[model samples]
Structure formats: structure tokens, C-alpha cells
Target: MGTDKPLIGFIGTGVMGKSMAQNLMDSGYSIAVFTRTKDKAQELLDKGAVWKESVAELANSADIIITIVGYPTDVESVYFNEGGIIENARQGTYVIDMTTSKPKLAVEIFEKAKARGISALDAPVSGGDIGAKSGKLAIMVGGEQQAFHEVKPIFNVLGENIILQGDAGAGQHTKLANQITIATNMIGVCEAIAYARKTGLNPSRVLDSITTGAAGSFSLSKLAPRMLEGDFAPGFYVKHFIKDMTIALESAEEMGLSTPGLSLSLELYQELAEKGEEDSGTQALIKLFD
Candidate 1:
């Protein structure tokens, strides 16, 4: 309601959050940050973020609270626990959860926020860690229309593309759609690369050829280069993709739908996770062939 620049408090400064928070600071917003690991906060702190000691403190001290934690459970703990944001945050504060989480939990949190006269939006993102680093993710948001408008400027600073899908958990539903497509596409990319490697073709050349045709895809164009170079460092971890695929399967089951491709992707990621490559990037799925 105020015309002043919003006081922004960001929690979960992991791979994605660190860069996103830096972008916010660069955009001239006052930032307060909290992370489970204190060292993750140093970059943002050096870049001018005021560090908060806890989620509750961050919520209490700022008007806008943005969470980019790892999973549904972590998100729940941060907002529902004894020292969580809801415990100390004032009414009229805005909360945007950017975690790719369960849609049901998103709805539950949004309802609780509404009862307290606070605004909450479930806005999950695509475009991976690179997107976060560049503030160019495609954000799908779901919440009250007015609240969506109120947060548009902040979203602009965080993402290159933003869309208000619907109310409550719609943003997460959209992200599930995103994951479903990604699950299958990544599988296609893996299979193609494996085929090329087995047939003694230059996988890099194969990547270049397909990427210029209709077969071109984000996973192929963006991830194939890294795969060709044998890089498995984290941009988005294999375990996290597994988590997202698991969420997608659960959502499809609830809707009485079956996605066999995603089902297989889930299984493959589980196998990769068991191999202790959980922290590796999703492109490491190529190791399935090895």
C-alpha cells in the first residue's frame, strides 16, 4: 500500500537464493537475509544485505519475505514451526514462496496468511541455477490479483518473465507442468547422447546438429555442453530434480493421470542418487549409461 521501496527479507540463500538476493540488492532494495548456513549469507552481506539471525526475525523486520528453500518440508518448518516467520511477522506483510513444493502445502500456507491479513503467493520458477544467477527465470505466480500486482516490481527484479497463473497453489501446479516437460526432455537428451557415444559419434557435434533443428531443447542446448565436458558440479542438483519429479508424480496421481516418462525419470534419478551423485547436476544423468 505504501509507495516507498519495500523492505525485502530473503531466506534460504542456497545456489539460487544467493544470486537472486544479490540482484535485489543491485536493484537498490534494502535486503535482510537468513540461511541455515551462516557462511552462505556472507556474499549477500558483503553486497549490502543486513543479515538476520532467524526466519522469525527476518519476517518481523521486513515488509516482504521471500523463501527459496529446498523442499516442501523445509518450507513448512520455516513458516509453521515455533520460531517460524508466522510467529513474529506483522499483518500486511507479503510472503512469496519460490520453492518448487507441494501444491497442497502452498494452498494451506496461503490460507493461513490470509487469515492473518498477510498476503502470500506460491511462485515457483524454471530456468535452473543459471537463471537465478542472471535474474532471468520464468516465474509462475498464484495468489490474490491485487497482491500479485503489488509484488510485480519485486518479481521484475528477480525474473525476466512473470505470469500470474491463478489463485493460491496455481503457481506450483504450473511448475509441475514445467517439471513434467523437463523430466521427459532430459530423458530424451540423455538417450540421444548415449546413442551418440555408443555409436562413436562426436557427442558435441551431435548436440550442435540437433540443437539447430526442431529437436533442439533447453536441456539439450544448455546441459549437453556441460555433459560433453564431463562437468557434474551443481547448477541444479540431481537430488533436487528427483524431488521435483516426485512431486510431479504425486500431483499426477492425485489428478488421476499417468505419466510414464516422468515415472522413469524419477526412477533413474533415484538410482543416480543412490550412486552418491545426489549433489551433482541433473546433467549427470548421463552417468546412467556408464
Candidate 2:
């Protein structure tokens, strides 16, 4: 809104959030952060990002607030609860939720924020942890255009492709479209690698061949290798992917659309969650084929 950089309050310091916040700091924005686990906030704190004891404290002190927490329930708690972001944030402060959450929740937040003279955007992201660390995520934004324009500089620091999809909740709708595609593509990536191993072909060699062809995708290019190496560490967690797929399926059904591939992927991932692989990466879906 001015020549001086806006003070940013960042909530959620885990995995991707940590890197996204660091990038903003690197871009010369002052940051105040709050997270459930104090330990996770340490790296940003060490880098001179001030730590707030509560979400309200962070919201009150910051000119712009960005959150990328887990689950729709968590989103509600952070924004709607007493002593939460909406209750404590100053008038005219901008709130952005980058979490892949329910589109309905995003609209509800927009309505509430509007009543309070605040601007809210549902700006979910893709490209996983690597994207966050490298600042190349694809951000799909939904909210007022002016609000998005105000925050475009902040988004530029965190992503490569930033788009304003439409009014409140549209960004999350776009993200669900993204998750649906990734859901089915992940299954293809896993099964192809599993099939290669079964046929005594080199999976890596197969990857090199197919990754350049029509069979190529982000998961095939990035995660298929992790599956081969037994490196299941999370670039994006299995549980979170399940949450996203569930949201996608529900949204599709409500729109009278059928998403068989998404449903199948959700079924397989649910099996992984049942086996306690929820903390592992989405790449771990290959384990189901094994």
C-alpha cells in the first residue's frame, strides 16, 4: 500500500510454510510468526523473524497475515475461534489462507472478513516442498481483485505462476482441480514404476524414457525416483493428499460431476493411511503396489 514493505504475520511454520516465510524475509519484508510448535518456529526466529505467542497477537501486529495450516478444521480454529485472526486482526489488515481447504470455508471467511473491513483470499498453492524452498509454487488465488493486487508482491516472492481465478472460494476450487489431476497422475506414476520392476526393466531407465513423452507429469518426473530409492520422506504428506482428494471428491459430487480416478486414488491412499503411512510422502503410494 506504500513504498515501505508491509509487516507480514505468518502462521504455520511446518514444511512449506517455513520456506515460504523465509523467502518473504529474504525479500526484505519484516515477519512475525506463530505456530503450535515453538520448535518449528526456531529457524525463522533465528533469522530475526519475531515470534508471537498467539495467532491473535500475530494478527494484531501485522499488516498482512498469511496462513498455511492443516485441515479445514484447523483453518476454522485459526480464523473463527475466539482470540483468533479475525477477532484480533486490525481493520483493513489482509488475511490470506494458502492451505488447500474447503471452498465453502473460504467463502465464509471472506464474508466475515468483509463485515469487519478486512480482506481475505483463498490462495492455495501447488509444487510441494521443493517449490516452496525454490519459490516456484503455482498459486491459485480467489478473492477480491484489489486484495489480490495488494498481495501480488508477496505472492511473487513465493511462487512463479500466480493467478486470480475469481471471487471468494474460486482459488480453492482451482486447487481441487489441481489435486484431482495429481491424484490420478500419482497412481499412474506408481503403477508404471511397479510394472517396470515386475518386468525386470530398470525403473530409472523407464522413467528417463517416459518422462519426456506424453506419459510425463510432475509426479512421474519428481516422485517416481523417490519411490525407486525407498526415500519416502514427505515432499507432501500422504494424509494431506488424502484430505485434498476427499475435498475434491465431495466438491465434484456436489457439482453433479463424477471423478472415478480421484475416487480410486483416494481409496488407495486411504489404505496407506490405515497402514500408518500417513506421515510419508505421496510418493509412498508405490508401496501399495508392492
Candidate 3:
């Protein structure tokens, strides 16, 4: 086919991926998409994107393939499953995986891609659903510089901050750090809210006060309102945050690091999940203390 414009295919159209793909299509890329459920692709298809039947079909048509699936296993399956991307992807095509996966998996996938003369990068993101919708996520990318530059334009359309961390698995490592920080910050915010309640202080007012002082953070400003309103809707699911935290702590363990805070948060998330709050927003972590 002709190469007038890059053929961009996106997999995983959940909360974050769907908005990201929509922004790319809005920015005028030739878009093709596939999700596990056919109906999830409907909005994009209606907006001028073509739908592919499977990962292989999507890879076949795309010059640049972007994956933003859920967990490490799902990320692996998208590229290596039956009728997956590697089965049909051609040499020299670029693949960027934006899933917050294990760094080891990024290294593994990068080696496999390099063996086939393809370029691969692990580029995970942050800034949550609002960021995804507003095209303001922070992207941490790892791969060859040339391939990063090649994809930078599309990333520019989808994110506000983009950093090339290092080699093959650096992005995933950076993402682990991100999750660790998030886990601690989330715990801190939830605990502060719980503390305020126990002390007969107006939790909302407590948040409003400290939020302007040194005790403030992005998490406090954003999630505090949700926690106060008892709105634990899945802007980002507790299950996904737990997955990220578990991956972070595991990575830390492999490096012989001490992260007691992360361990505590991980256990708390596990407890929350076991109580059927896994699908709820991570702000529901407050429920554990209540």
C-alpha cells in the first residue's frame, strides 16, 4: 500500500486507551483499532477508523502499532497470543507498548523485536483518565532514540510530557517508580481523610486547608473530593492500581531494595480487593480504615 501517512493501529480501548486513540484519530492519523470486545471499537470506527478482527490483522495493516492493555499478562497476550502481533507483524515496523508491565517483559519483547529487524519500546504513561481525555499524560519511553523520534509526533499529540528514560526496559522501571510513589501518596491521602474524620474535623475542609500547604499533592487535590463524596467510581480501577503496586514491589525486591511503604500499600490493596472493592476506584482504599 501507499505510505502517504503512517498507518497507526491501537489495541486496548478501555478508559485510557480509547481516549488516547481518539486523540490520535482527531490529530489526523490513519487509525485502525482492535479490542477484545468488538463493540468497544464502535465509537472509533464511527469516527473514521477501520476495525481489525484480531491483533494479527491490526499489526498487518499498521506501520506503527501501539498497545495500552491492562496487566503484564494481557500485554504479553496482545503481542504473543494465538493470532497475535508477532505472528503477522513485518520487519522494520515500530511497536510501542504503553502498558505498565514488568520491565523484564519489556526486555524480552525488545529482544524479540530486534531479532526480526523491528523496533520496540516500552512507553508507559501516567496522569489518569482526565489526562488521557485531555491529551496531557506524562509518557516515559524506553528504546532506541531514532525509533523514539519517529513516534514522538504521535506522542506529542497524546501527552504533554514525554521523556526518553534509557534503553529497552527503562520505561517500565520508571513506571514502577511511578506506581510506588502513587501507592504511598494514595495511602497518605486516605489516611489523612480517615484521620480527619476520627478527629471530628470536616474532612473536606481539612483537605482544602492542607492542600494549599506543604502537605498537598496532586492526589490530595484530585482524589480527596472523590473520597469525600463517596464516589469510588473507576477513574482508574483499584485492581489495576494493585497490579501496578505489586509489580513495583516485586521489582524492588529483585533489586534488593527496601520499600516498607509500598509493602503496606500493597497489602492494603489486597485486602480491599478481597473485600470485592477491586473494581472500585483506588480512593476506596479509605474504606479499609473505616
Candidate 4:
């Protein structure tokens, strides 16, 4: 491969990752991709992204590896397994984990990468599937300054707002904060719409009235319509949001912080998940009220 651009190895081409990898490919990066579900990667493979047989093969072939898999356990398996990225990647490769995982795990990955003379960054992103498709994600990164700088170009192709939070696990901590805020805001959005419907008011007009005022939020603006239209597709999965909220609650407890609103939101979402709405979008939280 030419030195004009780094070869990118992309793991997990699910809802957001598919669009993110597509943005990188559109920006002229050569990509190698791997995912457990081969059919999910068929689109990227057809778009000139070489399909690697495994994560290690992708690691060996690419100069920069980025992973955005499910759950913290999935993140651990991809990086710490015997045939994982750290062991198979060449020296000096940059490894970036964009999964919203535990901060301690991010630190562990960073330390292991440092021991092998590789650079690692925990770069968790927000803005959901629409943002990913539009290349307008907000990427919060944590790692060495130089490594952050080296990867900024790749991030620029994938997001509109990108910032390096601090070293090691800072990005995951930042993401938890983001998720906490969203948790409460989502409850408010659902309650407002539910109240509007119960009072015989037009929910759409009510949304227009408050959405431009202090009541407006990313959740209210983007997801409220989906709730109204009954489009419960997974822009961001309910199960994944539950995972994020669980992490946030644990972190908050560790810090001796109280988050009653976040706790309530988590409870409501857990009820939804228990009803088999786990595969639905986060907006499906409104379904409980409906």
C-alpha cells in the first residue's frame, strides 16, 4: 500500500460502524474489515473494503485498527484474546477502541499497547445512527497527545465535533457523562409526549412549541418524531443503551454520586427490555407510556 494514507482495519460494521467505515473509505482510506456476522459486512466488502478472515489478520494487514464492537466483554475478547489485535499487529500500529466500555478496561488496553510499543486510544462516540450516516458524530478521545494528533484526520472524516479528553480512560468516562444526561432527557421527552396525548392535544404541534424552547434537546428533536411515527428501528439499540446506563450507574456509585433521574430511566428501560424490546431503538422507551 502507498504511504499517502494509512491502511485502516475496521472491526464491527453494525449500525454506526458501517457508516463510520464508509466515511473513512469515502475519504480515500484503504480499509480491511472483519465482523463475526459476515453478511453484515457484505456492503463494505462490495465497496472495495477487503474482508479479513479474522481480527488478527486485519491487524497484521493494516496500520491503524479501529474497533466499535458490542458490550465491554466483546471489546475485551477482540483485544486480549491470543490471536487478537495487540499480539498480531506490527510494532507502531495505532489501535483505537471506540466502544463505550469500562474506563478501567480502556486503561488496561492502553498499558498493554504501550508495552508493545504501539499507540492506543479510547475514543467513544455519540450522535447515534443519523449522525454516523451524516458524518456528524461527536468523538471524545483519550490517549497520548501525539497519538490523538496522528488520528485526528481519520476522526475528521467521521465526525464534526472531536476532542481529546485526556489520557488512558478519559474518553469512556466522558461517554458515561454523556449517557447520564441522555438518560434523564429521554425520560422527559417520553413524559412530555405521553402527557400531550393524554390531554387530547396534538403531540406534533406540542413538539413544535417546546422543541424550539428550553424543553428542546437532541433526544426531543431527533427521536420524538420517531416515537410519533411508531418507527422503532434501531438508530441506537435499546440493549446497548441499557449497557451504557448500567456502566454509568456503576461509575456514579463508585464516585459516591447520586443520580435518581438516571436510575429511574434505567428502571424504565429495563422494564422495556424485559418485555423483549431489547432489539428496538432507544426511542422505544416511549412505548412503555403508549
lDDT of each: 0.91, 0.95, 0.90, 0.95
User: What does candidate 3's lDDT look like per residue over 6-85, in tens digits?
Assistant: 89999988889989999998888989999989798898899998998888989988999999999999988988877787
**Superposition TM-score, candidate 4 onto the true structure:** 0.98
Tell me the TM-score of model 2: 0.99
Model 3 lDDT-worst window of ten: 1-10
Q: What is candidate 4's lDDT per residue for 14-113, written digit by digit as tens?
A: 9999999999999999999999999999999999999999988999998999999999999999999989999999899999999999999999999999
Best by TM-score: 2
Q: Which of 1 and 2 is the better model by lDDT?
A: 2
TM-score of 3: 0.96
* Candidate 4 segments whose C-alpha is farther than 4 A from its true place: 1-3
True lDDT of residue 95, candidate 4:
96
Q: What is the lDDT of candidate 1?
A: 0.91
What residue pairs clash in candidate 3, if any at all? none
Model 2, residue 26: displacement in angstroms? 1.1
lDDT of 2: 0.95
Residue lDDT tens for model 2, 1-290: 78899999999988899999999999999999999999999999999999999988899999999999999999999999998999999999999999999999999999999999999999999999999999999999999999999999999999999999999999999999999999999988888888898999999999999999999788989888889999999999999999999999999999999899999999999999999999999999988999
